[model samples]
Target chain A: MGSGLLVETYVFVLAVFVGFQLISKVPSVLHTPLMSATNAIHGIVLVAALTLAASVRTPGGIWVAAGAVFLATLNVVGGFVVTDRILGMFRSTKRSE
Target chain B: MNTVIQLLYLLTAVFFMLGVMRLRSPATARSGNQLAALGMAIALAATLWANHRFAGGALIALAALLGLVVGSAAALKVRMTAMPQMVALFNGMGGGAAALVAAGDWVARGPGGAAGAIAALFTVLVGSVSFSGSLIAFLKLQEWIQGRPIVYPGQKAVSLLLLLVDLAAGVALAAGNLGQGPTPMGLYSLLALLLGIQVVLPIGGADMPVVISLLNAMTGLAAAASGFLLQNQVLIIAGALVGASGTILTQQMSRAMNRPLSNILFGAFGQLRTEGGQAVEGTVQSATVEDVATLLAYARRVIIVPGYGLAVARAQQEVRQLMDKLLQRNVDVRFAIHPVAGRMPGHMNVLLAEADVPYDRLYEMEVINPEFAQTDVALVIGANDVTNPAARTQPSSPLYGMPILNVDQAAHIVVLKRSMNPGFAGVDNPLYLNPKTQMLFGDAKASLTQLLKALDEV
Candidate 1:
């Protein structure tokens, strides 16, 4: 709710919009790699949520922060775990008839 | 404290931009991934430093360690052939996470926090639905579930009623009407479960790619809603990008199949067939490996077209070997790849790549379609629907107006299929009856190996 926080939020929003615009122009061939990298950003969110939960003083802010941290952590870890399991389905071994 | 976090946010944004830029080519994709990863790390570190949360350090570390082990195993073990399934599962996880975030917020704050409560409820609803829908898609693609559409009496009525109930719940939650009563979390979760089942139940095999794209878009929207609840600008922007792109991809896929989006959702074209309805009338010609090998050995130019059948049979290596043998005989061999080939986009290319097929030899549908006329032999390895000429010539066919490989234009066509069954679109192919086309019925790998031996005799 502070002015400094407002400015930070604005700058962050602008940067993200710019980032989206840049990626929109990328061709299809590069999508996989791009996605893999963006996926890691979930980790950053997890850390931020945890830190905020521990330090923030507002009533119930800790719970909010904790919940955010948990979700972000799940996004980061669960994404890759599921991806690997799905990938295993494609392994084709020769079946003798 | 704010200044440092702000700087970290800006840095994360820049890395995201650079990552997107690097995605323009496969050659730089790895570097792009690294850049995004670095950006995420910076943002996380800065946020943590600003808040200085240390109570759960040990727990977080343990979780991180487990993640690293599981992630590495998946990355190292997953085959390229199953990339779509992998994508679906990841999308589901992302959506599930977003939904859980919303659910957690709602349960903790109750209805007094109206704005947060509503946002959380909406995200949970959408995210959960997307998550379950995507999981079904994964099963369908993996063949763990039937590829054919499932329909029962009054299915449409049930789906419509479910949608109505889901909407009503959303409206009630948004109005902040449950302050003194028990939360409708149970109802909302049930609606989400039904929505998932309803959406995926009617989708047939041929429409899996389109369904995947649509679910992907839903997940993105759910993420954006969760971001709104958290008031995170970066999450909103990224989520919006994904949602928009996914929607566009779904549209394109629908257009490519020459079907309207509504047709895909409600018509359920491939789910059932009229009893005893026979395929379109056409002459059937059969061939042996020696016959196919003789044609290939004597031909100066050959074009190989692959489909889902090839992937199902795991025949990429044999096909590659056949190409190698043809190359030894000084034959000109090129692969004709359809844009919507196999079960998903780029499916054939990935399978072929695993077999170490030369990249230069693979040609997209647009580029190679015209050359089919000049080709001496169009060797279709386990492909059916995409190569069907009926799409181009038949106006009433379900697949009419769709783009297809011009293999029928070639001098001679050899089609390898397991049976005379129709493709996923549930339409008989006239190409199968063409005079120039010869059907070599069997498993793709087995047929290719047989043909290889017969070629040796020739």
Candidate 2:
């Protein structure tokens, strides 16, 4: 049986609260990095998208699932890699150290 | 086995949380990103393993390989200057994926019940909107479309009508009365996409960063809806965190601009404020590169104010070199960064960071505003709106009440620009006409290089 809708709603609401608390402390200078980083984290949705790929039976279903998988993978891999590239630039130079 | 899988998903959620938390500072941001990536890997592996009984393994493997190649190539090739557009594109892809997943599930399994139907409807609606809207934002940033807000008469009314239609169709679908085919869901999805385009089209380019953040949040919420349809806990948690954090980031960006969220989303900003043209009373004074070089070389204290122009000119390296040369001459030089200096949040900081400028020399608006008065020379580089005196002096001006860097307070101000034209807000800047300010008109890079050459000779 499903975990019931109420439990999922509870998780969603609590996670929202946690997100708010954690992100509020980020300073303005780190805002871009924060944005890019969060962009990467949300790529976890790929897990949901990929699960649909295996069970799809029809030709149309397979095509759609393939497209979804492609997009989700791009979101995850590109999101994380690009975010890392940007954050790597945040490393201090000799002057700051 | 189910218990172990749940525990692993829970651990992945924890790692995602820790990743976001670690991103609070620049020092730990890289590790934070790595942690999040690791969590994504664990979640993906667990999902594939638990759902192994499903068919089409070969197709899934092929898709994974294709996605990896394309994603890694795009990530590695994108320049830091185009990071905003890259983020918009990647975020949009995630939204598209969520929408597709929901559509796939509905087609294959049918909405199981009222709750399932509602979740599917929401995923389709929000995901389609986020996807289309982010694509528009990416195009705007990429200059494929005009960065200015595009609006026609009755645009707002039409957009509202589309939203209402989408909502009605959603309700119809959720009630299971929209027939067996995907007709109703398809119509609503199309409406949501159009609505997203209409809503974002009227926001000027200058406000794109905030709009991007808002859309990112929408995508996250859409993904959470997909999680609900699939009854997946980790997807829900990850989606919620991204959604909530993106919302806060949007609010913070809007606050930094000193504009209300509603105004940014709906405001057709950046239109020419010709009515406010009377704000500036004096003619601009022009100076040459040698004149600026002489002034800079002799100054005891110099504060550099960088704006979007610096990014456009790709002059951070030259600027850094000048700073180093001046420092070598025993001159006290610092950088004054405005909160909303460039197109994206912290745009200037990242550019300067890339140029290997010392992080210590960069002071935020509040920290450096007061110090401008004591400085001998305040150098303004390709920055217009952030340094505009109209923001402080003219209530009739569009930029009124927006806190600006006090570059005017310095004993002498040298502004580097190609022309006397207004900035992104398309409003007049009286600072250009100020008696204390000298306009050094040229390409920012060429002007800086000339000024640096002269300074070296001096």
Candidate 3:
């Protein structure tokens, strides 16, 4: 069990390094969208919500997990959709105002 | 079969990583977001398939579908000025979800053991903090709550005491594994939530972007702790990626503004520095829209500096109209955008781009600073503190050492402001008092409309 945590720690550390390197290179012009994208990415917690939903037996636990699923879905859906909408406006074409 | 599902999850994680890398440029960013969405679908499918036999299937599906519709509508309908609040709202939901997941895990499984207890408790504490903190941030950004730094006597002391108590409660609940009526778990979560509100309350004004980014990072870390509780590889990876990236980006934003990360967070810049008493000796010159139009009409080159006011007044389109007329008159026109010009980095860019302001015409501070000297007219619109020359010279000024757009260097300066009221930082600007600077007062949009009509007559 301890070894499992150690392995997860290894993965966590390496992922931090990867994220730092990748995001540091993105220009400040896109930092707003970059924040939105990362916000969407962490919505991966939806997986936890789904897994908990299946196993939770208590009525209270099920209700709690249901709420988690709802919020997680919102984070995933709203985050990516808003980010796409913003980035869509960044066209290079010179349109007359 | 389980191993296969884990492998698929890992593969999808690669998609997420690739998606983030694609954000390096605007050209590929839309496709990049699509790829990440694809990854999310795969991950969700893998989990749904894996957990098919688990209970509460009908309820989960209902919640997910309901969330999908509401989330989409909100995203599609929110106006650009409200973008910061929208992001804050979504971020708060993520943090709240992680905390609830952790809380449910503890209640359902009785912490599973020591390792589980630690992970679950950690997620519960941090996630709740991020949840409540982001909500307060949302209210402040939405202007539902006052944007001023809400401080009470001994605010710092209260925050410190609460934090210490929170940690102690977390330790006791974990070590003792106190399984009883109401549970210390609820107390822990409650304290953490209060701690979240305390954390964000004293932060106000131009410091919001950094706060939002930091809260984003906090939520990411909370999500990561939930990953540890669930033993989920993808959650671990994605959460860590967001946590780390959000942190680095926060520091970079502070650096871009030439301020320390700590100062940005704790300095409470607007509250600490009221407008300084030693005022400049020069008289304030007020000009009319006609005077500005004549100045612009005769100018060879003009640089326009935009600020939060432009965003507040929704004047980007009118500003765009002005720019088109200037170009039609054979007067060169460009926009000078300070990095922290709006509530968030790139806010002004998005607003201008929405109004069809060409990206090529928007010059960042570094590129546009030198050109101001050669320009015949510098049009300052709703921008105040960023143009304050004190940042460059005055040692006692709160804005001192923060990089500013050098609109003062232009041969002629016309400022469009509501009044002589100082900018958000409460630091009086010497630039407005300069002999060459003339303030043209009123709402930014109204003045722009008048200026446009005056330009036609000129």
Residue B314, candidate 2: Cα error in Å is 1.5
Report the error of model 2 at residue B158, Å: 1.3
Q: Is candidate 2 or candidate 3 better by lDDT?
A: 3
For candidate 1, write residues B1-458 as lDDT tens digits. Answer: 77767667667766766765765654565566566666667766776666555455545455545545655555556666676676666667667667655655565545435555666777778888877887888888888988788778898889888888888887776675544233476577678867887888788877776777777677667766666666665555556655655665677678777789888888777865664224577689999888899999999999999988888899989998999899999999999987667665456766776686765677877789899999999998877778878788777676788899999999999999999888777678888889899999999999999999998999
Candidate 2 or 1, higher DockQ = 2
Write the residue-wise lDDT of candidate 2 on B1-458 in tens digits: 87888888998999998998888777887898899889888898888887775466677778878989999899999877787788899889889889989988887888878888888888988898888999999988888999888889998889889988889988877677786565666677788889888988888878887888898898899888998999999989989998998898788778778899988987888865556545557889999888888889899999999988898898999999999889888889999998777777778888888887866678889899999989999999989988988788877777888889999999999999989788999988888888999999999999999988899788
> Interface RMSD (C-alpha) of each candidate?
6.3, 1.5, 1.3
Model 3 lDDT at residue B455 = 98
Candidate 3: regions farther than 4 A off: A93-97, B180-182, B272-277
Candidate 3 lDDT by residue in tens digits, B353-448: 778777778888899999999999999988888899998988888778888999999999999999888788887889988999989999999999
RMSD of 3: 1.8
How do all the candidates rank in terms of DockQ, highest first? 3, 2, 1
Could you tell me which 10 consecutive residues in candidate 2 chain A have the lowest summed lDDT?
A88-97
The CA lDDT at B402 in model 1 is 86
TM-score of chain A, model 2? 0.87
